[model samples]
Target: MLTSAIWLPATLAAGLFQAARTAIQQRLRATLSVNGAGLVRYLYGLPVALALWFGYAAATSAHLPPLSPTFFGFALLGGLLQIGGTNLLIMAFGERSFVVGTAYAKTEAVQGAVFALWLLGEVLTPLVWLGIAISVVGVMTLSLGGKGLKLRDVFGALWQPAARYGLGAGLLFALTSIAVKRATQTLGDGDVVLRALTSLVAVVTLQLVMQGSYVILRERGQWRAVLGSWRTSMWVGLLAAAGSAFWFTAFASAPVALVRTVGQVEVIFTLLLGHFYLREPLKRAEALGLALVVIGVIASVVGSG
Candidate 1:
């Protein structure tokens, strides 16, 4: 019911938040590459996400699901993997524009559907496969449309650091999806509070670990950067957090695979924002790619139904 209840609202929220995030990513891409800067931004975003989840939990009087060491461990591991994936994506953004970076992110839909079938024993009908195929085509169209690269050139670009990173992120994102579902099961609460709380703790814990480690290493002596980054990036982080929370909250009610597959709407949001706000050019090839992805998502929804 979360999806139906807040589906349009959540999607709209994700769109607005991602728009801002894309703008920040493009600005950072101008000077900083995605790897380091992207990671920093993700870490910064976690706290904002935490605050939102906490606020939601308090307002709803949502019950906390019971926790065990095993559950906590899974949450931590999944959070780490997701953060790592986001880092890879940031690196990808450095290589290309937000559109390409987002197209790469859509790979998670296919990855997640497969993982759900394998790990959660979730059923996928022929229609689901069709949807996946269509979505893949759309994603490919999006990625290749903007650049004038031929088919071979596009494949060759896969070897680039950013593409590799994006793929890596997608894989990790699939893993994160698994972890979240597992976390949801552990809580045994149909409400979104427990899941939100678990994610809040997990992300915050990881954020601290990553930041603390950096502080200890004095790697770049970027305390000034951290402080400055927080001021500019906190809200972006909050929006991403809200997006994550709503997504999983929706997951609490919907089929995990369906939720994730449909959630690929983030790519559409990212690409549109990339073009409108970041002024990233949309080429014929990319337009065709986007069309393919949209068609695929439609098929997926129908297939899943």
Candidate 2:
């Protein structure tokens, strides 16, 4: 459980950082919708993250992962999934509240645990399974907090052709976690460094594609709102960088299960942040979802322990 011990603080830090990421995204949206500012946010965020990693590497003497074409290929694939998932999530934000969108996204935990087991040969005990189950219930509670969910609605969402967008985003996010685990393992001792670099490359490349397309096809002013809010952009970039650094470190240090299980704390923190920062109402169902998420994730970790 030493990993768990390290993971506890990492979890706390990651949650706070994730909360900050939420704040950044809101600021981004307010300043610049999912338009130009969004693209700028993605592009600007990478360097800030890089600077932090440089500082960290300086302090820790972490060397860059020795890159071959192989390293680049693995990292490139990982970055594609990571950036694609994030793009989906950003798009979803316009359609749903951050709480709803993120809760759905956090279903990545169950997906991640499964992938870690299958791809990385990471094993979970029965207790961990219980925890995962508990967390899934919590996620569902939060996701369906608004409506009176019938079993049919859930099934409908699953089979609903229209709901495919949201489900696709979630599935892509799950795959991102899998790719990340693979890159980290492949990078060996420089897992953290590689993860940071990979994310930086992935995000920047995606932004280039998006922004270039927007520049070519859309109105010139489409990006006006994006860069207009400089203050928010700066803050969003800062928070995004900090959160990425902390999360990448956690991923490098702990087993993906424990890291992700603890990572579910983001929902709890996000709920609180939403209530206070966004003045959102806390519904009973959502509260239950939050509790279940925390308990389920904890149960899985503790049971495994």
Candidate 3:
């Protein structure tokens, strides 16, 4: 029972670990290319993912489930979309302001709801919709903070490169969530955590093969730097693996939209970490934004329950 009832808890833990991983990955950015740094997680995290999968398989006395065509399809689609979405975010960050780019990227929650509805035919309760809306607004407010961005600035910049890149990333990420969720379901009624771990192993392996090849061909030089700073990079991998495991767990246990809507708590974790760990100042809007996020998460949980 310790791990049996771990849906929302997994989501919360995923946010924390993801926040930590992002912080570490930020440090890696100083020395490695974006692709290289991104590669480190999947490259190094593969072993961890495999270990977790096998461990759970043994723990549950579960035989390796037969992999289905639908599973592979969604797994591959989710992996590829995750990579593409991440790359689009890089483009958005490069081509436009972080505030505006993040504001758009944060729309993944709402987009996820739509994707879940369209792709997975998941219908949500009204309270969950309220949660999604409130959380999204809070996220945008937090993102646009200190930039003097108005509602008009956020919506009016349709022609900007960031708009396309950020929104595209958001949609792709939304799809990735749906695809991953579907992938797990194809495994039948095995343990949810085991199903999730199995899917994580598959997706991470696919991503590693795809991205690892690119890194080897294009960013050959980054390997040396990546290894040189392995002390930090290793932690990045571990945190990434853990974060991904928790997220996959949550995805398997719940609706993707609800999972993502609740997952917006990641922003709160980010802000709090910045304030306490990094000694950063919390702006007024940010404080207000965090409050709204909390409210939204509560609403989402209550609706789901």
Candidate 4:
């Protein structure tokens, strides 16, 4: 049987790739509108995902798994929720500092466990829950910043655009994780890699059709922007596909809650990206928060073991 050891590395890799992809997508926002930059992820990623799935199938002579209504239902719902979550995160970028925006969404790990339990009937042990609580405190420490820790400030921040969008994004993303996990389980007795790839292909295709159609009909100008920026968009797509492939594979191998808990390391990657690439200065509070996150992740891993 596959264990947390099997899935841990994939989750860490996904976090790294996802952090980089998000940084790229955030940069694209300067050149393109929110939805346009968002479209690059699915529109460009479709081909890469398709190629990987087909190539693996050809190499292994793996036949397509039988699809069921439950599979389509989960895939469709998860795909749509992810698109919404992505846009909300992008929109958060516009409202506040990139690091803070991303940190707010990292709150998804805590909420994800609840959604996983409700939707998939997955439960966690006491130690794992302690790890999750520690991680949540770290994230909250970062999100509530020095100035934000005051009583009045905390209430005020919740109503602000960045906080509102970030929290909403977190909730939607939590739901998306649960849905995708359910979708993968529908492919009973299939190869882990094949199951992950098949689900990714289907989800990405659905996103392209739905998101692409919206861009064309409602945001025609953004459609042109998407075409004009193919060079950078391609990088965004490549990273998005790589990150998602790792994520799906990890989900197939382990419980979604544990995967997401470990996935919180994306906060560390985001901090590094912000400091080095964007030249954003790290505040003392942020530095402390980062240290807490590392501790939380370590505790979570040990607990899983």
Local accuracy of candidate 2 as per-residue lDDT tens digits, 118-155: 87777878888778778876765676655535787566
**Pairing residues by index, what is the TM-score of model 4?**
0.95
* Model 4 regions more than 4 Å off: 1-4, 146-153
Model 2 poorest ten-residue lDDT run: 157-166
TM-score of 2: 0.83
> lDDT, candidate 4, residue 100?
79
Worst 10 residues of 3 by lDDT: 94-103
What pairs collide in candidate 1?
A: 45-237, 131-300, 134-296, 135-296, 138-292, 138-293, 141-289, 142-289, 145-285, 145-286
Best by lDDT: 4
Off by over 4 Å in 2: 1-5, 30-38, 146-150, 156-163, 190-224
64-143: candidate 1 lDDT, tens digit per residue: 66778767776777777776787777777777667777677668878887888898887778887787877765775676
The best candidate in terms of TM-score: 4
Q: Per-residue lDDT of 46-75 in model 4, one digit per residue for the tens?
A: 899999899999999998888999998899
Better model by lDDT, 3 or 4? 4
List the candidates ranked by lDDT, beginning with the highest.
Answer: 4, 3, 1, 2
Task: Give the alpha carbon lDDT tens digit for every residue of 88-144 in model 3.
Answer: 765665664444455567689999998788877888999999999998878877766
Which pairs of residues collide in candidate 2? 37-226, 131-300, 135-296
